[model samples]
Target: MQDFYIFAKNFHINKAIIRRDGYIYQSLIAFFMTGTGNSYTVARWCAQVAETTGIGSQLVQIKAGEKRGAVPSRSLAVFTYPTHGFTAPWLIMKYIWCLPNGRNLHAIVLPTRAGIRIKGAFFPGLEGTAGYLIAFLLWLRGYHVQGVMGVDMPSNWTALHWGLSKQNAAVIIEMAQSKVKGMLQTVLAGNKHYDGMVQLLVGIALAKVSLMYLIMAQFILAKLFFASDKCNGCSLCQSICPKKALKMVGRQGRPYWTFSCDSCMACMNYCPQKAIEVSPFIITLFYYIATVPVFAYAMSYAAGGDALQWGISLGLGFGIQYGYTLAAIALAYGLLHVALGSRIIRAIAAKLSHTHYFRRYQASNVSLKDIHLHK
Candidate 1:
């Protein structure tokens, strides 16, 4: 009876050791590739949740577009990026492609967007399947996509729309925090959730040829940006550009936009003085009229002196028209700068402040300390 009792106690102790060892082995190491702008906040929140819930240890965070060392196969990877024009930014895609394929890797994709209310229903700020697309791409590269989620962040694109007020933004941030907590719970349970299928399909429909053309147009439109005398030669816009497309040159220390710009609008949105402005509507309209017909004729002539093919014609025509429009606008603005100088340009920009040409609204600056405190 004594021998049997001692064996039983030893067996229970061995079982407990085995269970603890298994738990330690199964704890996942997570890597988060955080996108720029508001995406940093979302990624930080995810890391915090993982640490608090004990779902993952050895968490690593890498900024989108930044270099990273080799990632291990037995790990969890989280990708977080801000949506641009209802799609993931190109910089995020570049990072995804660079990740080495691994059969045992698990992936979670989180896309942050500005929440918009349609009618009485609040649409989670996701415009399309930006999250699912990332998951699908990772799956293609041999990672098991555990989940995809959208987190509603305060909108920062004040160029096309007004930014959320401080009070409203605070409300949205709280709501997002709650949503993220629930998402982490589901993730820890080893379940999958994707809430943007319809948005995904719509995003796919819009992302094909039209998306390419729009990207090309943005490159051209970037040339239309000009700074007023209020610039103060601070070089803030130049420093903040992800693409390094803006250069501060000449004795006046003015910004010069190069062709390398991707039109992410980081410079304009983050400008403290709102000194950058685009050309007026009348000038843009005149440019389009002047260049479109000529490009259309040239494209038709190039196509064997026959009617241009629809796809080829559309692409070439729009590309040339946009390219010339931007060049002309820039040249005209440059000439004006040379003729009247910075003082006159500043006055003109101020006068056109109420016009649709200038981006009048500015996004509120993000406080890093506030984000850390939230954690």
Candidate 2:
């Protein structure tokens, strides 16, 4: 999390790579952001390759609101983060936005995605805009882009589906490590490599989905979290939220999600009591409320004549309706939080929530302290 780490032995660079331009790559620095630790693990593996190659290396976790000073001259910088929607997450985007100008500093982009294994078949995650978009931004910031690639790890979206078994996850992670090693080796050799061209092309076709994810879907997802009946008010999720998006509320100090949340999945996975849950009941309600608008009925009396004149659509007004949907869900969640105060109500809600019966996931190697220390 801090800006200082030397993975190389004794701070020594046993072999400094000399480029054709006469610049020597003596060290590496990887800035990574992770939720449930997949991206962080990929960054660590890249650093491990640096360590094995006798190159000095450092790791800096790309935390929300943490200041990045400047890029060191002669050091190769690597930017890695988990893919959200079809691209980079909000935390990754904000972190990159705040970095100082790269000034021709060499850099690479590695975006991790939700790799999965089902019935002994492995399916790779799609990077879509996750790789090149970040690279394009870095290039605009004066970075000499060395490579852009996608790495697949186990999916940690336990909110939507079941978590992978250990054997399945192990297979995916092992393949990812191999790719990471290869990508770093290419850069160290003074060559350029790029990957995910197919995913990028496919991602371009789905650009609208990515836009919706960034602008609206993520915000809506934030409202779906709640404390289950199993909660003990440990306050651990609140303490480790990267955006500080979780606040301890009420007499019991239970975690509450705020608008600042980007749906990073940190608070849900790392809760010691597994008290956090995503409400299926609320999701169903939200879908119906959002899709089947009440605005039409409320304004229906004048709508038959005024709709043709004033241009009222089925959504009433697309932008206004969307905004109202977000607001309505927020209000409903606020009431749900208040209702959860009663033990009987909380238990009933928990029984209806699918997340209550689902297994929670984090990277096997990742611990809550490891995440907290990263911040």
Candidate 3:
């Protein structure tokens, strides 16, 4: 993937319109949807490079309920987001969908995937639909796509595993700094550089998985979160949530994740108490509950026959099962949240969550002030 970081030597800056787009783009606008600040760092790098080239730049964090604003003349909008479940996050999708016709701007897209340096080697994550999905949406909105590239930032999904060591994370982030600047320079020079075609194809092949994740997996993951015994009830997680999906509920004021949570890791990584956790026991329970075939059994009993062998209305059964899964998870999460207020239950729940043992991550340089996660 070393070569993925560089462009062809023959590539030269087009002083004129960046391509057939036929516009002198004077400003660089970067819009980033970030959780742990990986995408935020990428946006800053692009903006810095553009600034040095005498192009004024603006950085905007994509948040829910953000109103549409006027588009500037001869401007290029760069979108940087982390890849979630091999595709774009719902926040970004809705942002683009709500965008007014984009005849006024050109666009470039960069999706930062989970990347890390281990034993002096760099491994990149699969981006899937994270890149083209957004580009396609931009194109449909009438923005000329200048380019699309996947950036390798330090792996920030700490809930599933440990975070990269500072030494290893710095290596990956340092490489990304140079790579993102190159991508921005190439696009600004009126040359098109579409990277990650192979990853895109592979992601397309897993479209069903991505779709299921977007609709079901993500929603379920949202409910798996809980504030542990270590929580001092600071409510920092509630204030930092970009979607405002986290609520401090009951007498304890413990943070409770709602369905609106995008599982963006903002709450998990930024908790000073290190108390936010994904309950493995609950997740496992959810997995078994979802596969219990309760819907099939109900239908079988209602019809006085074996519905399983009959392949009875698989589509309808799936829909019913999906609802059941979500409903069950939500109800279970509520009970668990309340239960955790107890010392014994909280201790047991804390032990069951792998995240309690895993190291947390956020970009080294970013602060709550930087991304407005605090505001």
User: Candidate 3 regions off by >4 Å?
Assistant: 1-22, 298-312
Judging by lDDT, tell me the better candidate of 1 and 2: 2
lDDT of 1 by residue, 248-362 (tens): 8667787777766655566776677877665564346545644556576647745654444666776787778767766665665456545334677566664564322444322
lDDT of 2: 0.81
Q: What is the lDDT of residue 312 in candidate 1?
A: 70
Model 1 deviation from native, Cα RMSD in Å? 10.1
lDDT of each: 0.59, 0.81, 0.82
Put down candidate 3 lDDT per residue, 13-96, tens digits, no spaces: 333344444558667778898888999999999878877776667787888876555456577888999999999999999888
RMSD of each: 10.1, 4.0, 7.0
Q: Put the candidates in lDDT order, highest first.
A: 3, 2, 1
Worst 10-residue lDDT window for candidate 2 reads: 1-10
TM-score of every prediction relative to native: 0.74, 0.90, 0.90
Segments in model 1 whose C-alpha atoms lie over 4 Å from true places: 1-36, 55-65, 117-126, 208-210, 278-291, 302-341, 354-375
